[model samples]
Structures are given as structure tokens and as C-alpha cells.
Target: MKKGVFLLCLALYAFSVTLTIFVQAAGIADEKLRLLSSFGSLISFFAVLAMLFLIFRLKDNKESKVKSCGQKQRKNPDEKNPSKEKYLEFAARNGLSRRESEIGYLVLGGLSNIQLAETLFISLATVKKHLTHIYEKTETSGRKEFAEKVKAF
Candidate 1:
């Protein structure tokens, strides 16, 4: 809709410029020619403004869609996913330390050891150690069992 309006404005500007040129060639009075040229200039200015408005409008529309999609994807797929407080509470009940809980959260999100190490600024060995502790504290072994325990929280 905005693009259509802008294109219509551009066509109007072209028409006005053509008319002004013809009026000038026909030997109209200087005052009349000046008025006609100025009118065309005004139309051209408005056409440019309309085009700019449409560009910005389209950009904002695209930005809004991307923002909404990002927010939607950020939602957890499982309806039974615990809130932050609930997750921390469950981790505490299972005797996991704060760092272990943080690691467990990322682990449950399916991050690999190298990815977890990079994200947490820890060594790969440290990531493996944290996972071992988490498994021990949660009484669950390996990725599948660990994830099942976290989800069952």
C-alpha cells in the first residue's frame, strides 16, 4: 500500500515536471513560469518525502516481524518447563551447586562439551567435570537420563 502511494506520487511528479517544461517552452509570462516551476518543485519534494516515509515504514515492518519471530522462538516448547525460580529450587533440592545448576541448564539445552566450555568460559575438562557432578547430584547418568531428570523436575 505504501509502495503504491509512493509510485503514484512519483508519477505525479513526472507529470508536473513535463507540464512545467511545456509551459516554459510556450513563452508563458516570467511570473507564471516561476509559479509553475515552483509548483513542480513542491510536488517533487513531496514525492521524495513519501518515498522516504515508505522506505522507513517497510524497514520498521520487517524489524517488527523479526523481533516477534525471535520472541516466539525463545519460548520453551514443553508446557511443563519450570520457571527460573522453580528450576533453581529443584537444583538445590538435588544438591547441585550454583555453577552446576547453570551448567545443567545449558546441558539440558543440548549444548556439546566444547560449546558449553566456550559459553561458560571454562575448559573442556571442566565442562566434563561439571557434567559428572551434575549427573551424580541428580542421580542420573549420561545426556538422556540427565535431560529426563531435569524435565521431570
Candidate 2:
């Protein structure tokens, strides 16, 4: 719908420009020619504004979708999955903090540092900090070792 509106505005602007040019070349009266030129300029200005508005709207929508999807993926790990429940229990057993446990669960699920950061709405440094804490608490060196240990549950 937005694209269609943008296209229609562009067409109207083009038609207005053509009309202004035709009026100019046809030797119309000065008053009428000025009026047509002003009308054309107004049409062009509005068309540009509409196009910009649509462009920004589209960009905002895409960004919103990404944030919402990230939020959805960040849902509580213990909600429905048996494996996640076990993982959370394991995290608790190992004395991991809540934030550390969350990061650990994502790591176990094979999320990269960047994915973890985006999904949890934290900085990459924060995610790394959580991972470090998780590793220390679980007696693991890194993601691979942690995954191996968690799977052993």
C-alpha cells in the first residue's frame, strides 16, 4: 500500500512537471503560466515528502520486526522445553547467577556471542562477562566444554 502510494505520488509529480513545461512552451498568459509552475512545484515537493515518509516508515518497521523477534527468542528458557528445564536446573546446581544461567542456556542452544547479545538486548561485552561467569561456575573453559558438560546431564 505504501509503495503504491509512493508510486502514485511520483506519477503525479511527473505529470505536473510535464504540464508546467507544456504550458511554458505553449506561450500561455503570464498569470496562468505562473500558477501552473507554482502548482507543479507544490506537487513535486509533496511527492518528495511522501516518498521520504514511506522510506522511513519502511525502515522503522523492519527494525521493529528485528527487535520483536529478538524479544520472542529471549523468552524464558524453562517455559516448555524439557532440555531447557534440565539446563536451568543444572545452572542452578552449579551456582550460576540468573543472568549467567540465561547466557549459558543460549550458549548451550548454539547461539554465538553476537546472537546472544542481540537476543538478550545486552552489549557483547556483557554477554562475554556472563559467559565468563558461567564458565567459572560450571568449571568449563568455554562454550564447547560447557556444551559437552551440559549435554552430559
Q: Looking at candidate 1, what is the lDDT of residue 59?
A: 82
Q: How many residue pairs clash in each candidate?
A: 0, 0
- Per-candidate TM equals 0.47, 0.51
Question: What is each predicted model's overall lDDT from 0 to 1?
Answer: 0.76, 0.78
* TM-score of candidate 1 on Cα atoms, chains taken together: 0.47
| Candidate 1 Cα outliers beyond 4 Å, as residue runs | 1-80
Which ten-residue region of model 2 has the weakest summed lDDT?
Answer: 72-81
Question: Tens digit of lDDT per residue, candidate 1, span 1-153?
Answer: 877887898898788778778777787777877797879878877877887888899888767654443332223465344567877888999999989998877666556676677566688999899889989888887977876676677
